[model samples]
Target: MSSDLFDDVFTLEDRFYTEGYNQGVQDGARAGRIEGRSFGMEKGFEKFLESGRIASKSLVWANRLPKNPQPGGASDEKCSEACTLPPLPKNPRLEKNIKLAYALVEPDTLSTENSDEAVQDFDDRVKRAQGKVKIIEKMLS
Candidate 1:
């Protein structure tokens, strides 16, 4: 009878332990998912913000490019007065770099999905755009 009692006690302890372990596992899984999602969202926002900044800079550079005055056409005196900034010099290399940078971060071309392939492509394009921007800055300076 004593041995049977001891066995029942041991069995009860084992059952409680198993239940506790299972509960812990479930809770851990839930917490992990929440944390992962939060991290992903933060990183995605940062990447998009950086890309947007680069794209805007490229657009401003493109707009500042000198306009070719057509023969017998009226000069854009109003534009010159409104835009206090001088036009960028006409350089093929500079123009190419500006266009490439803009294309790299174009919203329509970039994917917003969180898939691995999409993330990798986004990162690659942003990196390449950053390099191009640096080169363009050096050239301008």
Candidate 2:
């Protein structure tokens, strides 16, 4: 081939290679961002569900316990104190679960995107919490 033709071919090849490389980089970066965002949102939503579970579980156990009786007249105070129900025993396992739940739903937590899977997961968690509440009620009863 002539020198000019050879030079022209080389230049065209270099231009096509550069364009392809640049396009690939852009495409790869865009895909990476999307994947990262989706993964983060899923994790965040899981934490949110955990927080809900903690709240519901705590509520189930807390208000069920009887409160201490108030003291009346001086003469009756002693009797009232004795009649008051003893404090309910704390469940260490429940406390640990509550603490974990609180940590999961912090203000700085990331939010899940609006997707079918996320919605379904959220609904499932809510149903689980409700079932727990019902079981607790039966136990207390």
Candidate 3:
């Protein structure tokens, strides 16, 4: 082939390669955003469920214990009504859970840029925090 023709072909190939790469990058970013959104939604559901479980689980066991009785009604514990309830943050597990849950809910933390690996990092942290929360809950229970 002629030199001019060869040069033209190389230029076109380079342009096509560049365009493909740019498109791929754009697609990856978009995909990451969509995936991250779905993931965050799932995490929100999980947080709600876990929070409910943490708030209610201890109460389950606590209630099962025998209650004091008066002549007519169950005897009230001497402690204040609020004090007798489960502790806030549910427990130590819930402390970590609240931390992670708040982090997940924050908008900035859910970034999905293609080159940033935000999705992977967010997912990893969430999984790790969840595992830790479960372990803590088991210990508490």
Candidate 4:
């Protein structure tokens, strides 16, 4: 009888332990998923923001590029001298860099999915855009 009683106690303890472990595993998995999603969202927002900044800068550079005067018509000045920045000197290298940077971060071409391949492609494009922006800045300065 004593041995049977002891077996019952041990069985109860083992059952409790198993239940606790399973519950812990479930909770941990849930928490992990939540944390992963939050982290992914934050990183995505940061990356997109950086891309936007690069794109905006590229647009400004493009607009500042000197316009080719038409052969027969007078050049139409769009901005008043007080508001306008002096046009950027016409340089093939500068023009190319600005276009490349803009293309790298073009919104329509970029993916919004959370897949590994998409994330990697986005990162690669942003890194290349950043490098191009730095080179353009140095050239302009």
User: Could you tally the backbone clashes for each prediction?
Assistant: 0, 0, 0, 0
Worst 10 residues of 2 by lDDT: 102-111
Which lDDT tens digits does candidate 1 get at residues 36-114? 9999899889999999999999999998887878689989788899997788989999999999999999988999987
Q: Write the per-residue lDDT of candidate 2 for residues 1-141, one digit (tens) a residue.
A: 599888977799889999999999999999999999999788767766665655655554453333445577235445446654443346554444434443333334423556887556655654555555555445445
Reference-based TM-score, model 4: 0.87
Q: List RMSD in Å for every model shown.
A: 1.9, 10.5, 9.8, 1.9
Off by over 4 Å in 1: 11-16
Look at candidate 3 and tell me the lDDT of residue 5.
80
Give lDDT per model, in order: 0.93, 0.58, 0.58, 0.90
| Candidates 3 and 4, the one with greater TM-score | 4
Candidate 3 residue 59 Cα shift, in angstroms, is 2.5
Pairs that collide, model 2: none
- Please write out the lDDT profile of model 3 over residues 1-141, one tens digit for every residue: 598888977799889999999999999999999999899789767754654444354344344333445777755565446355453433544455545544543444544453448656655655664565566456556
Q: What is the lDDT of residue 66 in candidate 3?
A: 37
Scored by lDDT, the top model is 1
For candidate 1, the per-residue lDDT at 24 reads 99
Q: TM-scores across all candidates? A: 0.87, 0.46, 0.44, 0.87
Cα displacement (Å) at residue 56, model 1: 0.4
